[model samples]
Target: MGGIGIMIAFFAGILGSLSASDYSQYTYVFCAVLVLTMIGFWDDRKDMRASHKLIGQLFAFFLVVVLGDIRIESFYGFLGIYALPISVSYALSIFMLVGLTNAYNLIDGLDGLAGTLGAISCGFLGVWFMYAGYAVEGIICLGMLGSLMAFLIYNWHPAKVFMGDTGSLPIGCFIAVFALLFIRENGEMHPSAVYKFHAPITAGLSLMVICSYDTLRVFLRRIRRGKSPFTPDKSHVHHFLMRMGHGHDQVAMFLGAIKLLFLGMVIMCSGLNEHLMFPFVVGLTIAFGSLINVVTLKRMRAKVRKSPPISQRYPIKPTATIKSKSTWEDEPVLES
Candidate 1:
């Protein structure tokens, strides 16, 4: 069900481009990610190996980075890091983009999570592009935002269908490109314009706080468990919520609320004090996430203790016996 919807969205964007006779750098974004969506679709149906999906994702990133020339050229003084050598910047750009793509992919563990979060991210970026007077980028962002919003009508918790890989892969690809463009745009602006108004890098990171941080958390967890980072498990944030007894819709709401709050704080604090904003928000996110984990474990332990024992839950009720008089001897009769 979701595959059909996602395909319709894919074609809608393509046909919209052709109808408008729009051929531009960002348009190639949808075109470049064909490999990713294809591999993702296959994986959904056939359950492809993780290694193969990674290879396909890397190739998609290569298409965007090398051919489309949408690489991040600077950090714009975030961490006091700027003016990287061309070689180093190019390499860093590739690695970050690929990682962002997969990180967004990882957040697709629950209904409406990818769609809700992706719509919010791209919607904010779309408005930013409009503010920056980049009509094409605005169009791309709006297009993606619209498709995701439409998909959510069906993909919402108690979902009629899912976005699957076809939807999630493209979302990750779009957001990664948008984040890079957002950061790169800041570089072209006057330094003081950034200092007084925004911290583009941190703002962009916060736009995706859920995916980026959750991916890092999941990777660290898998590593500590002596498992491959790519190994699938029920350890994602959604799984954690599910284990805590959150219904599917409730988990979606849980994450949607966090995403909104993070985006709001990032937009607000970034303008006031760009220097301290990123780390502060990150610290808060980490703290809140860890608290959730600790609380979940504690509650789980308590719940286990409070629950009825298996034997009691399925008790063998004893039968009543009735004393009976007989000529030969006393007979026992079971009583209903």
Candidate 2:
């Protein structure tokens, strides 16, 4: 179901492009991703292994580099980093492309979670590009948004199908490219501009906060316990929520809501003091932590409800049959 929606969107975008006649820079983007999307679709049906998917991501990222000339322009003032050298840009971009692609793929555990969040993030980036006059980037973002919008028809509550790693990997790669372009456009303009209004990076980071942070947290926790970070477990936020009694649909909706709220708050706070972003990040972390505690309490309540009384665990046998001695002389208590 999700695959069909993506096909329809791809065709619609192609038709729109043909009608325009005047080819745009986004033509390369659409063409480059066209093959990758098919590969993902094929893998979705065939159940590709992790190594195969990793190789596919490498190939797709190379396509972006070779065809689209994709590169990371800046670090957005983090780590005292500014412009990246050519070699660094190439390396970093590849790593980011693969990382984000898999990060989103990992998060596609519930219905509507990955698809809805992808749409919201891309839609925001599209608008930001329009304001920044990056028309090509904006069009690419619109194309992505369209694809996700179509996917959501089957991805919503009571989902008929999952996006699988196939759909999610492409979605993640698409968003990463959009963010790179967004940063390149404004990051190349002026330091002040990059600092003042970095809606694209902020939006992208905000949307995938749960996925990214959880991934990192699990990695660290696993390393601390001498375990492989890649090992699967029921520790994911969605999994814990399920254990806490949230239906799959409810968990998906709750996660989507959290992403949107965080995204909105970040957008609203972009113009505020530099100190504000830190506090917002801290607050969100706390909120997520509290949510986990609530889920824990819910699980405790479920355990309590499921537990049987001591008598049920170990039945006490009837000791004897008795009668009132005064009422019936012949009816005496008989001990068992």
Candidate 3:
């Protein structure tokens, strides 16, 4: 429903030309999203192998680069690495694009989990773009958000159909592309109209931290365990919640809400006060740290509960072997 609604609205927006960038935005996202949707939808039904999916993603990424003219211009001062050579930026951009696609796909296990969170993230991003005066990127975010909102109609709790890899992969990739477009280049600042806040890149990262962090953590854990990172398992945060007695619906809601809460903190500070980026970051760090502590405590409690008590370790001996004596006494009486 949400997906359909967005599709309709995008078409309508294209027809009406609500914004100058709407046309280009719709066309670019439409083609890429359609291809991704088809590939993902098919993969969902028929189970496409990892190799095939990777190939498809590469094809999609190349298409965006060639047609949409998407490229990574800069890192926004995060790594102390500024202007990259053209070739390196191109390579890095594609990598980030594909990585985002898969990150969302991997996080799409529970109902309303991926779609809802994606909507929230994109909605925030879309508004930020509009506020920053990047109308094209803003429109892109809004269009995507609208589509995902429609998808959630069927994707919420007791989901009728999953978004599968088809939806997740493309959506993720497109978002990365959007992020690339939104970031400022080395020594090339955006126009004053585009941003009313401190830094664009930090805002982008904060918005996407949930998906990025989960993907990074899982990838590292898999590498450390000498396991294939592509292999699927019940290791996601949502899965942990499920194992810890959360119902599927509850898990989905919890993950989405947590993501929103983080973004909300960032927005409330950054948007309202306009100089609270530092405080926003600090607050997020504290929240995430506390979350980790809670999860650790739950695991410890579960482990302790599953173990046997000390009394069970040593069974008491029987008080007497009276059955044998009774049998002997009865036998003697019978004989007499």
Q: Stretches of candidate 1 above 4 Å error?
A: 1-4, 10-22, 191-197, 272-274, 314-336
TM-score of each: 0.86, 0.78, 0.75
Give me the runs in candidate 2 sitting further than 4 Å from their true place.
17-24, 190-204, 222-226, 272-283, 286-294, 301-306, 309-336
TM-score ranking from best candidate downward: 1, 2, 3
lDDT to native, each model: 0.78, 0.70, 0.68
What local lDDT score does residue 68 receive in model 2, on the 0 to 100 scale?
A: 70
Clashing pairs in 1: none
Model 2 agreement with the true structure over 1-336: per-residue lDDT tens digits = 265467567557846754454345555555546655777787878866768867766877877866678778667665567677878888888887777766777777877878877888788887777676666556657777888887788778788877765567667777777767755664455546643444434544565676776667667778888998888776677777777777877887787787777877877876653245655665776678567868677787878788898889999987766657764586554655
Per-residue lDDT of candidate 3, residues 76-175 (tens digit): 4545655778788778877877877778878888888888778887887788777766676676678778777777787778888676675677677767
Instruction: Name the lDDT of candidate 2.
Output: 0.70
* lDDT at position 42, candidate 1: 91
> Which pairs of residues collide in model 2?
none
* Per-residue lDDT of model 1, residues 2-33, tens digit only: 64576577457856754454545455676756
Best by lDDT: 1
Model 1, position 142, has a per-residue lDDT of 78
Residue-pair clash count for candidate 1:
0
